[model samples]
Target: MPETPKKLTIATRASRLALWQAEHVRDRLQELYPLCEVGLLTMTTRGDQILDRSLSKVGGKGLFVKELETALLDGRADLAVHSLKDVPVDLHSPFALSVVLERDDPRDAFVSNGYGSMDELPAGAVVGTSSLRREAQIRQRHPGLVVQPLRGNLDTRLGKLDRGDYAAIILAAAGLRRLGLEARIRGYLPVEQSLPAAGQGALGIEVLEARADMHAWLAPLADPATTACALAERAVSRVLGGSCQVPLAAYAQVQGGTLAVDALVAEPDGSVIIRARAAGPVADAAALGERVAQDLLAKGARPILDRLSMPDASA
Candidate 1:
């Protein structure tokens, strides 16, 4: 008789986008292993609850991910599926990013009711965005507009837009597409306009380090291109000591056997922007990213980052 297949339970946030990503993984796993049992352990994270203030104020990247991680640590779930951007570049022991799916559009989307694009919006127009990266980029490009802190999930943010609260808003093009809201996007900001966050538009599967037995089960789901790009982008963040509080952005693209990376660090007020770029063989993606990060730091990124707010939850 054949041995029974192992059951897999994935932990995830209750947000529509998070659910979609988890369900996607579940469906893929089912297809790969027709006899395996897959389940979802959905929970609300602290980031989802504390919506009054900026995510930076409450807790940076971990706020969105801690609970799901806890579920995995406590053995309640076999995996934690997350948006790669939300996962911290510096991970703790016993927890490892075991798999990464192919990336989606790694650009920021401009969504509005009447405006066709953010460039067309008149001066003093209010733009909603939760990310410091988007705010800084918008402020630098369109100083005439008002950048407001917009928090909450996709539906809530869209609700605010529909309610006439913001003239325009910026969001990850990937999320919009994943939710079937791609039609809501009016335009996509070019990479030069808004460098995406590290690991944006990708999915990461987190599993305990001790679960070496499961590696083969998940390895087939990994996308080499996305993994290389994500590593390069995350290397920039790691080398720069960046978190949500700091207005930092990094994007990496892989072509053939080479990887090109772009990174930026800015003051929250959007007064200063330091940017850098690098390209090298894709096999050296992490090294390429670190080189760009060092290039930017040598160009005065550290002082600006020091003056910026550090939102460490433990502190």
Candidate 2:
């Protein structure tokens, strides 16, 4: 008798962007292993159901990932597809990030119907975004613009703009491209103006650490440069013990075998901002991130960080 065919199950959130990412991974896996059957298992997360409270207040970035991870832990799924940024700084030991796909445009884009760019928006124009990092940056740069809390999936946010609820909104450029809505973006925010969230524009495939066969199968998809850069970005968050409640942002990129990392921390109200950068060999990505975080913390980021770390803040 012939041996049974192997089937791989990929778990992901049901959101359009999440499914797109899962499908991207599924196609790649199928291409590499012709005999393997790939299936997608979509699940909803706590973040998806709680639109009323800010992510930071509700439970930080982990809200979007915990449910999917649980599915993996329960043996219902072999792999979990996640937005790199949404993964927490610390992860459970049994699980490991097996592969990181090549990153997309790791910048935030300004999506607007009336304005050409953030600068062109009329004074007092309502700009929508759910990210505290973006909210703080917008406040610093365009103080005159009104920052409004907007939540829901990507399509829902854009629908609000179409319905005249907002003049503009900020969203990740990579997501817009994934959904084929890049044309709606009026301008892309440069890093100088808005440092991206840690691990932005990247996709992470996570699986059980003991699954050697699965790891070997997925290894080909891993991009070393992207992985190094993402690790460096996440390192800043980890070193600082940051969560969604803290207004923190970090982005790293590898150029000519050198990794450059930029990180920032701001007061919740956007009153104080501390920014720093570091460069080193790509192999020392995590160390470089720690160095940058230490520098920022030394430069009075500690006080601002203390306020954010208060226990009741997350509650």
In candidate 1, what are the lDDT values of residues 1-315, reduced to their tens digit?
134346989999999999999999999989988889999999999999999888777768788888988898899998999999999999888889898899999999999998998779999899999999889988988999999989999999999999999999999999999999999999999989998999989999999878876667888899999999998999999998888889899999887888999999997767889999999999998999999999998999988777565444313
TM-score of candidate 2 to 2 decimals: 0.96
The count of backbone overlaps in candidate 1 is 0
Give lDDT for model 1.
Answer: 0.90
194, model 2: CA deviation in Å? Answer: 0.6
Candidate 1: C-alpha RMSD to true structure equals 2.2
User: Could you give the C-alpha RMSD of every candidate to the true structure, in order shown?
Assistant: 2.2, 2.2
Q: How many Å off is the CA of 117 in candidate 2? A: 0.6
lDDT of 2 by residue, 141-247 (tens): 88898998888999988999999999999999999999999999888999999899998999999898988777888888999999999889989998888888888
List lDDT for all candidates, in order: 0.90, 0.90
Tell me the TM-score of each prediction against the true structure: 0.96, 0.96
Off by over 4 Å in 1: 1-4, 309-315
